[model samples]
Target: MDSGELEHPPAEELQVGPILLALADDNRRRVVAELYERSDGERLCASFDLPVSKSSRTRHWRVLREAGLVHQRSIGNGLYMRLRKDDLESRFPGLIQAVVGAP
Candidate 1:
């Protein structure tokens, strides 16, 4: 399949329960915050500096992606992740802002 032709999962189909559970972790919350701080067009690679092991990092991102908090795509050998700001803001107003603001 052509890379441009691949479709990503819709935000509405995300599993809210699992997502909430994943976000309950401090490390996962930090990852979400980092993505939130980026510009709308920015993307974070899976190889970025994270405090967790490779397998655990994969789990964290998978939970976020499955929860609809982020969009993930395979680019060559790396997986790139981006925040689903619009969908999240619409679902829960000010939630992202509040989380980003929290100490």
Candidate 2:
């Protein structure tokens, strides 16, 4: 331990690799796409029709949230998801477009 110094938690760091990894999954891609296309810019987790199971979706959401690619809010038994477009774009310009934009 260094004298007269404060140790910061590792969780404070936001790594880009996890964000890229979250986008690497096809199902996560779909979820991000839906959230991107939503007129309201938010959606209930139940509203998604992903091919993966609910548990799988939960995992995907966790990855996305952890990567700072998505923001999640819980409401009773469900989750509300919103794309972190501004944050993402601010971090890496045109990244979301390059991934989420392509057909």
Candidate 3:
């Protein structure tokens, strides 16, 4: 959601270093790839079936959010996440396609 409760960097403030660092992890990359593949391009955080523990999953979400690769909002007890596609595209054209290796 646009008005997210969680703290994350603004799209304009997104940096290559943090985004690359966050994407370096396979699990985090998987999350990005999955998000990119979806037409709607949004999903609940719990909807992802990552191999890591719940705590680790939480950490991954933080990394992605902090990197400005994703936006997250709390809905009741669950968190909803979506790729910052338009923002990313505006800030760094072709970056997502190059990183995600999407066709």
Candidate 4:
């Protein structure tokens, strides 16, 4: 990994199959939306007052990260997440926007 790039589970190494399975839910979508609202350089911590079990919330986040939809960084005991906007946009143009704009 580059010095500036924090060590992360390689998006390539992650099991995309499991990630896809986990993301096929409404709750996961909400989690993504919540993260999307944050400004660049900001991260969404798991403990940020969501109405869900901690275990379930963790699973949701793992799905996003493993699927290459988001990037996760470990800071102390907390895991912070940010959407992989540019990467995903390049892979699937307008996919992020379509999902975010979905009602």
Clashing pairs in 3: none
Off by over 4 Å in 1: 1-9, 13-16
Cα lDDT tens digits for candidate 2, 1-103: 4653323213345567887888888888888888888777788888888888878877787788878877777676767888877777777788887898877
Best by the lDDT measure:
3
Worst 10-residue lDDT window for candidate 3 reads 1-10
Over 4 Å off, model 3? 1-4
Relative to the unseen true structure, what is the C-alpha lDDT of residue 61 in candidate 1, on a scale of 0 to 100? 75
Write down the lDDT of every candidate, Cα atoms only. Answer: 0.73, 0.76, 0.91, 0.65
Tens digit per residue, CA lDDT, model 3, 38-63: 89889999999998999999999999
lDDT for model 2: 0.76
Candidate 4, residues 44-70, lDDT tens digits: the string is 465566678888777667666667777
Best by the TM-score measure: 3
Residue 19 of model 4, lDDT score:
45
Error of 4 at 90 (Å): 0.5
TM-score, prediction 1: 0.78
Ranking by TM-score: 3, 2, 1, 4
What TM-score, over all chains together, does every model reach? 0.78, 0.80, 0.91, 0.71
Per-residue C-alpha lDDT of model 1 across residues 15-88, encoded as one tens digit per residue: 55766786788887887888888887346565467787989887777777777777777767666788888887
Pairwise TM-score winner, candidates 2 and 3: 3
